[model samples]
Target: MSERLSSRSLPVEWAPKVDPRELSIGIVHLGLGAFHRAHQAVFTEHAAAITGESRWGISGVSQRSASVREQLAPQDGLYSVLTRGLDSPSVQVIGSMREVLTAPEDPAAVVARIADPAVTLVTLTVTEKGYRAVAGGGLDLADPEIQADLAGRPPRTVVGQLAAGLVRRAETGAGPLTILSCDNLVANGPFLRRLMEDYAAALVSVPEARVEAVSSRQRLAEQLESTRFPAGMVDRIVPATTDADREEAARLLGVRDEALVVAEPFIQWVIEDDFAGARPAWERAGAVLTDDVAPWEQAKLRMLNATHSMLAYLGGLRGYETIAEAVRDAELAELAGELMTRDVVPTLTPPDGLDLTAYGASVLERFANPALKHRTAQVAMDGSVKLPVRLLGTVRDRLEAGAEPRVASLAVAGWMVYVAAGRDVNGRELPLDDPQAARLREAAASAGPGPAGLVDAMLSIESVFDKELAADKLFRSLLIEGVGSLQSH
Candidate 1:
């Protein structure tokens, strides 16, 4: 074997799509993780390669941790995306990432990067929790990081950091910025904008003008108004890299790759074309630039994501390790389909040139890709935060249309049972690793020992279920029945 994967070690054939040394950082990306490296970074590289443009290089910031920064820094910000299809996996080195920054280590540097005039665009994939919204859809004022940022800390939280950066932009007269959120949150653009507004509004209450916040409240609001937060829908299954995966990557490359990320063959990004400043021509790289990303977002959130979570909870409870193994089980496979067709499909307005039937089939096929090795317990995490965006909308729609959301309720029930049981059928520990795990488990434990009891107890959680949904006799009955049936397994 050769030395580790660096700009120096790559074979001629495996040279990055774009030359790393020549490219300059024009995009400051928050949440430098597997998904961003596999999805957007690759697309940006492709877009640059096809257009012969090199200004859209990325400055990746690892927010929660410095591990990703550590992984890629020695490699000259280089990494290989191992695309695992049905047959053999394909390895490609990505070069668009020019610089890596750890947000916590140098929060001011992150704000400076965002404020840099050369960096016209900022993107985020910091997951749902990164948004840090209260259940009622505003910035979580109680979050300590937010409080710290408002109290004149260096802005550690994502929202705090973004607010600081935008305020910096306003001060510097850096032209309008396009803040594209590449997470799976519903109406992500508008949601993020609202969070920013909440943050900016909260800054006003700080008796003294916070140094990290805007000195002029109206000026910061105007800067926010000028900025564009475009909603984007991204799809790809990037699994946690294991030693086996690293070994395989080494075998393929004749060199060890520390920052190797693996993914399924399928990858798609549908972006809303509402940028406030110049941006990458992502369409050149096979991204869909559309006027309305809502339909696509809705379809993905409800159909694929909701179904994926359903399979995860159900499959984890049934003792399956990976999603492929779970979907391969005939009964679990059938349940996934029913959730898609019977419950989710009827509620969606399929985007132009999309076939709900074919999309459903393809999603199932993607889920069944064994090479990806997407874990059931991993997807099963953060169910309380995920359920509203992924499943509850369908439940609400079906109920509004005067129909029973049977399979959807079953999906919700799967989560409930998974949380309560905390183990698979074979006595393997299926971790209840949710942001709201403590509260949810407390509710589960306090409930009287039965399906109805669990249902009644969880329904009382206003964060997950509103007054109307919790009050619905049909929903309660379905959940109780669903929970009861799953517990019998």
Candidate 2:
């Protein structure tokens, strides 16, 4: 065969792949990253292929990065995805996207696309921290970004931006649109809609004092009628793209394609039964559409995400770089598996007819996938933002049921040590990434010799975990032991 064609110049064989001119951006995805490309885009591509509907093509939008735009814009948004595994590797040109819009390049244009009637679904993979969760996915109306978007000037943040675009579309009678949140948070859709509507109302409301006067409980219960935030459960381990990914893409395509996304061979999308506007036939392409995504969400959050966090903080502190490496440590891996099967899984009410044991086994296998070098730092970042749902939620749930939460406490303890800001077992510096990282370090520094002091800081931060849990004796004691083990080790 001849040398590979330049990614900048499409080959005749690939021109029929994804005709950008023939596609109107029907889906607007925020946070254009590897997960989105490997998971959502690939699903949409398959859906369109089955139905022969070019309108399912996507218009990717990125708020901060221009690199994806530069690379994808040249190739007409047709990039290749390589799914590498221990035994096999598969390559395919994913054609779900029609173009990309980097917000910095033209904010107005990006907003206009969201407002477009042709765009019926707005998907996101902005991660757990990016959602800015407050009290069980409750709306954080005090957020300045929400305030700004409500004022109708412009949005500085993701929630604000989505609200702004939705308001514009709503005003234009663009009909109903589905806001698909693909983050790891439990009840991801409702979490997103809460913020979107809360922000939009702040824009039209009278005063901040009056808005606050309306209690969040009443506000949330009232807004359930008109909104369509479809909760989803997503799985797949696509690590942050390293320099090697870019080099490999260049070599494979015979030209530099900056936007190439690399991932493992696994993907999944389980969504709740709600969609208002036009939507792609994602079910035709293997996506699960059901009346409830709660069980799946709960299962994934408590098992996959919670276990990952445990490994992340502990492994990062122990000087393990990647999750695979961390799990390879006999003790840590065994501890992780034990925490899941014993503590986390037992607390959860598994979906009807689902085998919890099988699920837990699968989670362990995925974590041990050697090909996906999911870094501990990447998972460990933003503890304050992630802990509420990823860790504390499960702990709080089990506690509410009056069940023993020893393993959960250990996870919390791991978080405590991880946040202390120091070297791990190997003496390599552990660079903390929480929003309150500095404050946490300062507190741990001034804390007493026991883990009680460390646990106190984490629970006391009303911004991070539930305040009621702070006063519990068992919670504090377990965390203390957890801290003592690592600190002493």
Best-matching candidate per lDDT: 1
Candidate 2 structure quality by residue, lDDT tens digits, 88-146: 55566776777788876677777788878888888998877676547666666666655
Q: lDDT per prediction?
A: 0.89, 0.75
Q: For each candidate, what TM-score against the reference?
A: 0.98, 0.90
Segments of candidate 1 deviating more than 4 angstroms: 210-216
Lowest lDDT sum, 10 consecutive residues, model 2, at 215-224
Off by over 4 Å in 2: 1-18, 205-227, 250-252
How many residue pairs clash in each candidate at the backbone level? Answer: 0, 2
TM-score: which candidate is best? 1
